[model samples]
Target: MTRTLYLFGSAAPPVFDVARVIEDAQSGGWDVCLGLTPTAADWLGEGLDGLAALTGHPVRSSYKRPGDPDVWPAADAVLVAPATFNTINAWALGLTDRFIVGVVAEGIGKGIPLAVMPCVNAAYVQHRAFERSVRELREMGVTVLYGEGGFVPNLPGQGRKEAYPWDLALTAMDDLVPKREA
Candidate 1:
């Protein structure tokens, strides 16, 4: 059976390229559903409709009211690409003030496999909370693609949008699923 992948995004600039990420996830045999942080949703602006079409689901940015039925299918995997510094810190603390964070917090509690690729600058990564968050999330069984082999930090004011390690996050998700021997 094909697995459902929830592609979550933050306000980082790279979240604009989420269509490409959706394509990648789809090519990997996953049915993609997207949820963006509020800021990221605003950033999408006119492009939001296109993304919704690509995923065949509404691009959700807020939580539905209580007593509302589930809008999307259960997620088999979750990828938070362009995960911002604030989002990282908030998610690490299990804060769920927004839709994306709520999904992340719930996903973790439900033991859903999660892979995150944070898009903060080099200086941002030096913040105590950033490192601590990465460690904390990892301990929670979230696959944080960071350090040498995963996401290499870029200098502040010199963001490398073209070079973000989207592949590694996908690979991490692939690693989460056990492969059947051919």
Candidate 2:
């Protein structure tokens, strides 16, 4: 069975070209489902439709009305790239204010494999709350790709979106949810 991966993006510099990640994951055999934070969705501008086309499902940013049918397939795993400080903290707090957060919170509860690559600046990583949140998520079985050997924080004004490791997120998801060989 082809594994479905829900790729969630936050409002960070790397999100603008997140399609590259989707394409690479597709090549790796993930049936990608795109979802974005509201800010990320707005930042995408006209690229939203193209992203929906790329993933073959609507890029959901808001919760659909109750009773609405789910358009995307059941996710076998989730990858949150460009996970901002707010998203990391919010998710840890179990805040389901947005569709992205809702999915993440539920994914955690359901024991769905999850990988998060935070794209925060160096200063934010030093915050006590952020540090605690990362540790808490790690305790909850989240594959947080942060710090050394993962996503190194960039300087405040010198974000190297080009260096963001989208591939690593997929690799972590693979570690969590092994693909079934046909």
Candidate 3:
């Protein structure tokens, strides 16, 4: 069975990088579901159509569609790359404002492993609430992949001294999938 991976996050520089990661995962034969934050959708452009083409699955951004009876597939794992500080806090507090949060909450309830790659400003990253939320997520058994540095826009030499490798992210997602018994 192909493992379902739910990708969620905010609009940051690493979002482009995250797209590459998703492409790699698709090439590796994983079924991918993308849920973008409003801000993320804006930055990503093309309204997930490109992502849908890449993954061959419908990319969901909202939960307000009427008569959309297709049940979201149970995810084998959840990856929140380029996770904004706002998203981190919302997830930590169980806020279900959007499709991404709803799916993540559902996955957590089902005990699915969740991997979060946080990319935000240094000030926000050091905020007490953000720090506390990170601790809480860790306690909840979510694997937090810490990205180095903030995603500053239009600033030369100011973001991610070493960006998280796409392959490493894919490997982490693969690790969450259970090996089938032969």
Candidate 4:
């Protein structure tokens, strides 16, 4: 079976540059599954449809459809980029109200590799709860990229001055791609 990577995050940057990331994964012979938070879908506008088309798979946002065969993919790794404070806290606490968090919780529990890229203000990042959560996730073996050491809104053409590592988001996927079975 093809290794699957679950993409989770909020839609902040208008040009989040996800197409190339998806294409790269496909080229690596891995299946891509996308899960968008409600706020993310709103910010993405029509970009969500474009992502679905690119991956040839429907993007999931909620956990209401548990019986759907396609609700969750057999992901080999889960990458939560542009991960909002709310999403991070929710996932850390094991609240699976949304599809993305649900799948992440499931994946982690099942021993699948997981990576998180938190995208929130530095103040929020320093919160004790957030710190504890990050530590807990690490203890659970999840790779938390922890944004680029500060808080910055995701905007295109802003250079690499922001705290978030947009480029590393894709690079993390490269790290997660499974080796072909001999």
Candidate 5:
């Protein structure tokens, strides 16, 4: 049985590498379904169709119409990489204005294994809410990789897109929900 991974992304510079990340997850035996925040979808405009094709499911950035049949299979695990400060705080505060945040917030109550790797800068990290939000998510049983061993914040205006640790999030997700033996 193939494991399904709901890979959701926020609008961070690292989101530009999401195609490669999806491929990596697929190689690791995950049937990936991609979801994006509204801004992230806008940022990936013109390439959204390509992402949908790559994931074998629609790249959802908005809530589906009520009563609409679900498009993707049930998720066995979820990874929200490049989670922005807004997304992290919004999720912790239960503010579900964005599709990705809404789903991941619900994933918590649904008891779905979830992990997040924040892509924030040092300036953003100084905000009081940022640390509180990370703690709240961790207290909620979410695997948040945001410190020394995971994604250390870079200086503002000095982000190293190439250095974003996508592997750390993937590895943590794999640990949380191991792939089933076929």
Candidate 6:
């Protein structure tokens, strides 16, 4: 049985390369469903359709209306890559204002295996909320690859977009819920 992976992205530089990441997830034997933060959707702009086509699922950035059928299949695992400072804090606090945050927050209660890799700078890391958020998420059984062997903070205004650990996040997701052979 093919496993479905919900890959959610925030408005970090790595989000620009989400199409390639989706392909990578697919190659790893997952049916990829893409979801993005509002800013990420806007940033993706014209490429949204292309990403949708690539994943064979709509790139959702908003919640469907009440009673509307879910477009994507049930997720066997969730990977939140390039999570921004705001995204991490909001998720840790259970603030579901954003579509991606909402699903991930609920995914926890539903017991869906989840992993997140935060893409933040050194300045953002100094914020007290950031550390608390990471701790909270980890306490909730969420695999947070924030430091060492995961995503280390770069200096502000000096982000190495190319260096974001998309592979590491994908690997963590695979570890959370590996695909089962038919």
Candidate number with greatest lDDT: 5
Candidate 4 lDDT at 122 equals 55
Structural similarity to truth (TM-score) of each candidate: 0.95, 0.97, 0.83, 0.80, 0.98, 0.98
Candidates arranged by lDDT, highest first: 5, 6, 2, 1, 3, 4
Per-residue lDDT value at 175 in model 5: 95
Per-residue accuracy of model 5 over 47-141 as CA lDDT, tens digit each: 99999999999999999999999999999999998899999999999999898899999999999999999999999999999999999999999
Local distance difference test scores for all models: 0.87, 0.90, 0.72, 0.72, 0.94, 0.93
Tens-place lDDT per residue, model 6, 38-95, is 9999999999989999999999999999999999999999999889999999999999
Pairs that collide, model 5: none
User: 1-182, model 3: which lDDT tens digit per residue?
Assistant: 57778887677667766557777777766778787888887777774787877767677667857876765576778888777788889889989987787777677768999988777666676579988888888888888766443223223346662554445566777777754443
User: What lDDT does candidate 6 reach at residue 139?
Assistant: 98
- Candidate 4 local Cα displacement, residue 33, angstroms: 1.4
Cα RMSD to the true fold for all candidates: 1.7, 0.9, 3.6, 3.7, 0.7, 0.7
Model 2 C-alpha lDDT per residue in residues 65-128, reported as the tens digit of each score? 8999999899999989889999999999998898998998998889998889999999998899
Candidate 1, TM-score vs. the true structure? 0.95
Candidate 1 C-alpha lDDT tens digits along 1-182: 56788999999877877899899888887889999998888899899999989988888999998999877898888998889899999999989998888888898889899888889998998889999999999999898888887877889988868788888888888788643344
lDDT, model 4, position 43: 66
Give the lowest summed-lDDT range of ten residues in model 4.
154-163
Clashes of each: 0, 0, 0, 0, 0, 0
